[model samples]
Target: MKNTRIKNIIFDLGDVILNIDVPVASQSFAELSGREQSEILAIFNENEIFRQFETGSMDEAGFRNFIREILEFDDLSDEAIDTAWNSLLLDLPPERVELLKNLGTQYRLFLLSNTSSIHITQVNKILEASTGVKKLQDLFETVFLSYEMGVMKPDPLIYQKVLAQAGIKADETLFLDDNYDNIQAAAKLGIEVIHVQKPTTILEYLKDYAV
Candidate 1:
């Protein structure tokens, strides 16, 4: 039932490739906001400021300002904000990077991530520091950031855009994401999906895929 003709692969960034600890970020925000982590996370869950930043409606400076206004942390320095915002980002293991680099030669690789500028800055630092690989973009045919695309995952537009831009049929492409909602969205559009989970790494899961 698998599509052997699949020529393109779309990958998600956080949790799938890079580790993210949301609790660490929540704790950082709670300390800054003088609120419980639960309250801060609740606000984050419903916050338009976050959506706007991720969708490129706001830049890093604007996002910092919005955080100050929303969290009532008027004294929060830009450095502090960037640090706390990037708290959730963890290491990008060298193995993952090697796998991606190898896969690039065998398939058309693409990266799709819902992220902000501050986080991306840290992500790049981690990648370079961990593997001396300065950029993942070099391995990808094209990298699609939600911020750059002005649309986040689970949205039809982002999926449609990638498919159209790559000139690939949805059924002939595979998408890998950590979030079920994101996978579901792409699946609805006819893309094959692998729900990348914690116990299984991307490389392990794809060992038999398209082989």
Candidate 2:
């Protein structure tokens, strides 16, 4: 059930509103690097590559170059590296965009994502191509990216920043994301949260809070 006091909706990008092809990313990486899926994933989880990218410690080209070098690849073209890096991004559903557009009419909407420049570039290319869908930039009152913000979700500070930025009370905002740790982080901050596992579909989970 939603908090009856909710006045704003804050959304997470990836699996919440956008469909991420994790398998595509993993498989592509494995094939390109000649490493087993487990090995590649282990590096992803063990190292803070994604985290560093998000925090702007590294740029997209640098990130890709590091991956290529780590895998001992010999001078793969930047485009090829980018393709492997971007293979995970998929289109945002038109219906979901519509839902956000309609909701934007009533409540404040925000986009807070733990994503990087490379990944967001892929998302933007796909999203901008859609005509009828609400542009992600337009749907939100403000956009906060972890990379640009110097913080990531599941960190209490990020949620605090969102609330502070929106000028909304914690209890007045409903935070949505696919990651449980992030949901838990926001919950600990006294903001209401929803765990969205279904990619490209949020209306089902938002029924209780629909205005």
- Best by lDDT, which number? 1
Provide the lDDT at 114 for model 2: 90
Q: Number of clashing residue pairs in every model?
A: 0, 1
User: lDDT at 2 for candidate 2?
Assistant: 62
Question: Where does candidate 2 clash, by residue pair?
Answer: 54-147
Write the residue-wise lDDT of candidate 2 on 1-211 in tens digits: 7667878999999888888877777778898877898888878777767788888888877887777766678677788777877888876777777688788877889999998887777787777676443346767889899999898888889888888887999888888899899999999988888888753358888876566
lDDT of 1 by residue, 104-164 (tens): 7778899999998788888988999999988767668898999999999899899999999
Cα error, residue 8 of model 1, in Å, equals 0.8
Name the regions of candidate 1 deviating beyond 4 angstroms: 1-3, 209-211
Give the CA lDDT, 0 to 100, for residue 130 in model 2: 65
Stretches of candidate 2 above 4 Å error?
Answer: 131-135
